[model samples]
Target: MPYLNITEVESGVTSLAAAFPATDLIELPEPTFEGRTCHALRIGTHRLEPKPAVVLIGGAHAREWGSCEILVNLAADLLHAHAGGTGLAYGGTSFTSAQVRAIMEKLDVVVFPLVNPDGRHYSQTVDPMWRRNRNPAQSGGNPAAVGVDLNRNYDHLFDYRTAFHPSAPVQVSDNPANPDQVYQGPEPFSEPEPRNVRWLLDHFVRTRWFVDVHSYTQKMLYVWGDDHNQSVDPAKNFRNPLFDGKRGLKDGLLYAEFIEKGDADDSAVLAERFCEALKGVRGKKYSPEPGFDLYPTCGTSDDYTYARHIVSGQEEEKILAFTVEWGMDFHPPWAEMEKIVLDVDAGLVQFCLTALA
Candidate 1:
């Protein structure tokens, strides 16, 4: 059975701790965010050897089990690769067990697989597809049930898209104050989970490839989502069945190829690169376009991470910050979910190797 409880997660952490000094559990204090405190189990790399660090995160949204599942799978792989040797070309790349172990020696891997544990707990006990921290205020007379949508609550583009897009593709919601969904809270970092995430990243993750995993999409998402401009969106632009064509315009269509990790690209660059990469694979079914179809939602962690780690700093080379939407969150049948999980895991691993490696 899949591990579903915090107790199980704790056991996983403990196992890592016993095996390597690289692993440690981090707790997020309460009241800062209405959800359960998150934990970051860091896998250390030997000091003499230097390898790229990757931060894996999941459970930002309650129903998105695929994210955490992938994270857990990767964790298991790392442990196995460390203990023995297994990662081979069956994965399509030259990632051997020895190489994985060597990579572990040089690289530090940190993961916070469960970001909104309270919300996830509620999802398990209450609604299987629940998305948001459990605030539980809404009742007979309650006006709203808006709990902070961790996916929407990041510090970057903190715009409240739910407020504007009442009829968005994803209809899942609760009263803003309901604490069940769509509640961004009084401000960004208002919730403990997010605050702790910010605190940890700010203090610990100096420079790294940070991925905030989400689910239910066939494609991997990169950056620049708040604006909703069709042109200035990510690779997803090509995925749009309605996308017109690549206008040979570098403005927003295909610009990611030019980005040099820490190139300090603006929202424009991020979106451009994302769309450009997708355009190549979309084939004739989809075409690259301009303008962000997605509106400008602020306080988004992707935007925040991009700005802080890639856009602003000069000391570090470049940090690739990404918001990976695995797939739609509400697909029925467990088998379908398993397929998506595999695709997402495999595709993302390839993407990381190609994009960040």
Candidate 2:
């Protein structure tokens, strides 16, 4: 199964709305950068009141074109669920509209769908593995500085190291025209792309499930990015404490993440919560509690969402957020990707459904 090109994904989003007119779809204009205009999709929120919002974003990495497809397919499934009055689907499992919508009402569902449009375009047109923006900042003598890793450019933990480039690694970058790895540029929030993400997160404070979909890792990561947060309070309170006292494989994964970070406090019990929410799935494989731990990162969407909720001064109370890394190279012809989409989509939607319910 070939991955979806950007235009095909856009058409998919449009078709979703066409299929379900009761749902309102809005395309948020992207801030202009280097002469091109950027934009994102705003879906749902039609008849539901102050619904619990979930932000679904994808393709921050240039080469991971499959993420955009997974998102589009999920949107299409959601549309079908919308018009047909069925619940969200998995291989054989189905969660209901009344059940799911009841959960969604608690949090309005907002999906960015795809973020690195230019990089994505570059991937489709120029390089299959391109990872940054189309801006010229990465060109000239600084060719390696091609694309600012949009994922790494966020205001939160802006200096946190990336999983791939702990220190800057010079490769034939996806945005080949650019230079600089961990090249934050002349100023903070310098890139309009990540800044837009900041603005988007700010726009929806009540979001219960915050997901930034990416490829290459078959894992879902949650809150308190970077060692900075750990060193600061050490009070797991900064996270959304939904997974406390939870059990099972999924919970085990969540617990292992927390336990490893030395954050075994009550707030670190998210594993339990995640597992509880995922209790219905059968015949699925999940890692048992392992000593293998996820390295901490800063300025991540996860940390930002958690911070928004935990801090009440100007932010909303703890809203749940997770960085959903579906799998490496899960791009597709629909058949191959469906399992990945259906599996993670089930978990992502169920999280929101439970939060809103």
Candidate 3:
């Protein structure tokens, strides 16, 4: 499958609503730097009422075109199954018509297939590796200095003092410039793209699951990307109560501890199920791990969504968030595109089924 341009993706989403009258194609109020419209496709039954909801977002990093395809195709498959009164079989698990309809009635699946339209257009038309939004404001209105890494522009754990240099505190640039690939803008939610995402999360009360789709790493990552510890309070001291005095450091370090144990465990199990479904299709393996385990990144969408409930003292309402990295590389060749889509689509379907269970 050839990578879809911004216009094609938008049209594809709109066409879904046209093809299936039950589906809704909503245009987000915020526009990109290039004046491209941001759209979200809401599909499933009981959309008007509150229900268990899943939000699937892609193209946050414009060059990861595969993510967009997987989401759009998934939406299409679901709509097809629902409208035709047919079932779907994936990863050896059968989703009966009854089960599918039950999920639709009880779950709302909203997909923002393409989040950064301007950056995606730039990547597809101008540069094949453009990883940020085409926001020239970061570069002081310099056209060449365009882009703000949308992934890093979220509100959770935003380190404006340190900027892009995650490891070192060494001052590189006085201003928030795209000097490197991971420029985190002047402040959190600085870019409109991610702010729109935040808006969706805020308004959608039933959003229980959130998956930020990206390409190339072949992993499913869960929250707390800012640091090793999962605790919302950075200064909170932690000591392993179970640690015996004889084994190593007596003073328990406040590192990599999960603030919410039950939530973490449940999220881990769901991710494992997703990986299992992926392997069921052609035996492709996708590792399930924490986001910080891969690398320490601040202000990621996954962390922002997951941590919001915890920070707000609403642990029961915490959204189970994950970043799904599909395929083996950012730009998987056309030869592998279809299979990649199928594999990911299976995993996603399994994820939705798990929600119902």
Candidate 4:
């Protein structure tokens, strides 16, 4: 199956859903600007009420075709394993059928295999470098300049004031009209793509973990993408105390404190486990670090999901969010895609196992 286009992705998802009747294939509330349906393949149910849920999202950036394939294949593997009543082997570890069923029974696994359908279609058919959704409204009605980096369109820590770093030689754009890289929309959750993602996270109250899959970097990234310091001590790192009152600097400080003293250690441990499983296949290495370690980014889905728990003050239900960067380039060669998908699938399986463990 060709993984470069949205049609193939949709077909694969449909086939999987047909094969696994238990899987719920849900279309997002709204379609992309190009009228392409964005589907979320949900495995398992919420009837158990508040089960630990893990959401795996891919194709956020249109050009990263490999990410979508990895997610689809992973979902298929799980469904096939359940259907055949067979165990799954990964990272030299085998999961028994009972264990697999336990995971399915206890966790609500939601996979948005292709988050940006319009962009995927555009990249596969038109430009292979398209990185955003085809939302012409954001481009002053100019079709050529229509695209919002969905990765930077999430709601949490979305204020451009905190995210925008004017001093950095390379920075995300505040102006949508500029039409350079990293054009965050006029406001947070401004685009339908991100709104769909937010809708999923909000509707699924049991989502305790999230993984936003992307490609070419081969890294496992944790939250707080706006800050580069891996070990940012909240006490000394928070410079803006009263910049915009309680909802502004105060909230930011509290977020930083949670990062430093509460979530960082556990998040790093989960990332390390994921990287270890990934390396087990073909000896591929993946660096495990904070998201900003690669570069400062804001409005990212992973960070937003992580912040959801922090902001809610739900310590017990804190969502462990991550961004898994696959392969070494945005568009890796077709011949190399199998190994890439297998490696990521193994890592993701291990991640789910860890969550259930």
Q: Model 3 TM-score?
A: 0.88
As a TM-score, model 2 comes out at: 0.74
Q: Which regions in candidate 3 have their CA more than 4 angstroms from the true location?
A: 90-94, 141-144, 160-180, 229-254
Model 3, C-alpha of 327: deviation from truth (Å)? 1.0
Q: Go through the candidates in order and give each one's C-alpha lDDT.
A: 0.53, 0.55, 0.77, 0.77
User: Which residue pairs collide, candidate 4?
Assistant: 216-329
How many residue pairs clash in each candidate at the backbone level? 61, 42, 0, 1
Quote the positional error of residue 240 for candidate 2 in Å. Answer: 21
Native-to-model Cα distance after best TM-score fit, residue 13 in candidate 3, in Å:
0.4
lDDT of 2: 0.55
Better of 1 and 2 by lDDT: 2
> If scored against the real structure, what TM-score would every candidate get?
0.70, 0.74, 0.88, 0.88
What is the per-residue lDDT of model 1 for residues 1-357, given as tens digits with 9 covering 90 to 100? 553465566456556667665555666555323434456676655643455666667877877765666676556556666666576332222355655665566566677777777777767777876787765443334534635677655654243342223333322233475344555555566666777667667645444666777754433344444333333334432223232232212234322212232332333344334333333332211111211233334455665665564345554734556666654555345665555444445443443344343
1-357: candidate 3 lDDT, tens digit per residue: 488888899888999978987678878878877888888988887657878788999999988988888989999988899888998776464568886787677888899999998888888998888888988775776665677788887875464343322232321222445455577777888788998898788767779999999987899998755434454543331222332121111132423435566777778888998999889888888999887667666678987898788678786677999999898778778778878888888888888888778
lDDT of 2 at 3: 70
Off by over 4 Å in 1: 29-35, 47-52, 88-94, 136-146, 159-180, 228-296, 309-318, 328-332, 351-356
Displacement of residue 39 (Cα, Å) in model 3 is 0.9
